[model samples]
Target: MRTSRTELLLGRTLLVVALVLTVLPLLSMLSAALQPADRNPTGLSWPSDPQWINFVTAFQVGHVWQLMGSSALIVLGVVPASLLFATLAGYALGGLRVRGGRAVLVFLVLGLTIPFEALIIPLYYQAQAMGTLNTQWAIVFPLIGLFMPFSVFWMRAHFVNVPVELSEAARVDGASIWQEFRRIQLPLATPALSALAILLFLWTWNQFLLPVVLVANPLDRTVAGALTFFQGQYYSSIPLLNAGALIIITPAIVVFLIFQRQFIKALLQGAVKG
Candidate 1:
């Protein structure tokens, strides 16, 4: 089947429009960030004298290094723990026989439907009870649990498409269940795990509400949450604020750029599995 010329033209036009819509704001923000800090930069127009020092000012004023460290800590805690648990659960559910696995899966799928907003109150109080409030663990622990449903779903989607023959062949070679999972499946799961890691990192990095509500100290907040605080503190400094905002989101952008191929492959690999 071939697309008609009119359809092709229309599709190209739509894509161009989408690209502009996406890129225009980023360009506008970059322009704002480059403007002189003292001179309030208005709109997307390039400044007369581009002040690259706005980033330096924002970095210092925003305490961006500290924010980066805090966000990194959360990402390290959440991604590894969540991935380990989700991989194990996903493997058992998707690739192995478990008693009442269907019921368990249904429960996890139900968890996906429950919004975080609904759970925040209880989590806050629970953290307070545990004496972890105002600490990084407040964010770290909840995020891991909060991420479980989708992470498990993602891993299971990958694992379910894995052929049973691989497991059977491994079993015939005197491989135990743990041996098959560790030796055979995990090696084959690299792309999917990479994709999951990227997503987990992004989510854990960008988490705002949980940290804001649970942690009182600004130093303990994730970059995204700290950006909000920084916005309030520097509301008068438009260029600096924009610069800080850009800096806050840079890690996620870089991660996506580096792993984009593997990420796309993981998502699409199961689309037409043999």
Candidate 2:
């Protein structure tokens, strides 16, 4: 009983520490954003006037709405494409029988080993050649491709946990393969799908490097890319930059918060079942 109490205390302490670690930077950024322009470059300090207008300025002058729109386009396109392709491919690789199944699975796994940085140059030239460069599709296509290997691997693991009897029963009932997958397997795979959707949304939203190389104009840049415009070679508008950063990060935070319970439940379901 004494040892259990001590363990509980330790766990609480650890949780508090983790919370502090996670929140410190966020608090600092907010503090900085609120600080007056005159107070910015003198290191960190409490806000004197607490200018709330910086957010508005960031949104308007900083081209935040355009960035948000671009980011949204990428996320909307990439998320569905990634999930559909990943789930279908994963289902095939995990549950269905096909010639070269193992070989195809191996090839997909090999994709996970190759880092994105290595392919950026080739991808850039290819996008340019294909006339997709500077377009939202350039960023969307590459992100979908980059995220697929991991999504497939994860969804495959989830699909493996589903009982084969379900598919077999559907088959016996004269259901076609498409009907079986669409009606039975896809419904059962919702938790994994939700989890994957949240993850893919976040990944695509936060993407900077790909957008940097693929897009040259601010009109086509993502929120992540737009944050870079706040800095100069010598000086940066720290307050405005922090405000922009906050604006950029807010959607993702709200997304996770709104779906947090679902996200956790899905994670638990995937872990236990898979």
Candidate 3:
């Protein structure tokens, strides 16, 4: 039953290669970001006189703080609401096994097959019709709807694996379904919920197209979405552009690092799922 040493060695080698591939680009970016503003960074070579102040300049020019605030507002609107509704839907379909749940799940799963690119045109017109175009709410509302299928599927994956006996026991004890979900299954779903929150946060944060299309004012868009405008505005300065990009992505990296344990725990928990 033990893993062979040769298999272990090959696995470790693959992981090392993957890590190197990931880190190299980030190192290249950092090296480029440290070079003097208005100077062409030829490649990934470290600058002899690194200009760390370029970050400060990029921040001011890019309005990094304001972009961050705008992105934060959109994320706050989307993730929590998505989580709540998806969890409820997942519970009903996966745990409660309510009538017609499979039909509902099938309908939701169909959403997973439809590309966001395909939906953008209709969504733009819908936003315009609803008079939410050029506002963050335009992006916010669509993202929540767009995120629902995957979010429900993710939560359902966790819930479907819950022991049915627990639900039966709760019912026999005269526990209402609400009480059972809130006090029992919900507590046990922490890992799934934590992982889902992180994923939704990352996706919503890096979401570029929706914000770009839905919100006309670049400053009103998410940071990632506004990078196009940022690039145009900072066209003369490669270093400053890289610095601005790094500044924008750093928060996502930090959040992932901080909660990586929960993320991994959820993965491990789901590994044996049906």
Candidate 4:
């Protein structure tokens, strides 16, 4: 009983520490966002009068709505494409009896090792050849390609955790391979898929380098790129920048909160079964 009580106390202390560590930076950013613009030297302190208008100002001055629309278009295009391609590839690798499946998997795993920076110059040239530069397709296509390898890896791991006997049973019932995967395997992969969708959404939303390099027009820029607008050669607007940062970060936070359980489940799935 005494040992159990000590363990409980230790858990609570650790939770408190974790919460503080996670929240402190967010609190500082919020404070900075609210700080008066006319202050002598902007420091991280609670505002005497919180300027809730910073958010509004951020929207007006930054052309935030346009940036958001650009980001949304990229996310909408990339997430579904990545998920569908990854799911089909993962199902094939995990469940099918095709020859050279292991080789394909090894190639995909190798893809994860190659840095995106190395591919950017080549990708830019390809985009230019395709007449996609400064267009939404330029950013969207590369993000889809970059995200696919990891998505396949993640979904394949989850698919492997699903029991082989389930597929066998589906086959015994006269289901075709496609039908079995659609009806049995994909249904069982919901938790992992949900987790992957949220992750991909976050990643695509936060992508800066691709958009910066591929897109030149501010009208085509994403929220990640829009943050750079607040930084100038001679002057910087820290508070407004923090406001933009908050706007960019809030959606991801909301998504993680919504799918928190699914994310945890995906992490825990294979540990017990495999």
Model 2: number of clashes?
0
> How much lDDT does candidate 1 score?
0.89
Instruction: For candidate 3, write residues 96-214 as lDDT tens digits.
Output: 88899889889988999998899999999999999999999998999999999999998888899899889999999999999999999999899999999999999999999888778
- Work out candidate 2's RMSD over C-alphas: 2.7
Please give the CA lDDT of all the candidate structures.
0.89, 0.84, 0.89, 0.84
Off by over 4 Å in 4: 1-12, 40-44, 233-235
Each prediction's RMSD over C-alphas, in Å, is 1.9, 2.7, 1.7, 2.5
Off by over 4 Å in 2: 1-9, 41-45, 232-235, 270-274
Instruction: State the lDDT of candidate 1 residue by residue for 234-269, as single tens digits.
Output: 778788888988888888999999999999989788
lDDT of 3 at 111: 94
lDDT of 2 at 53: 88
Candidate 4 Cα lDDT to native: 0.84
> Which candidate tops TM-score?
3
TM per candidate: 0.93, 0.90, 0.95, 0.92
TM-score of 4: 0.92
- What TM value does model 3 have? 0.95
RMSD of 1: 1.9
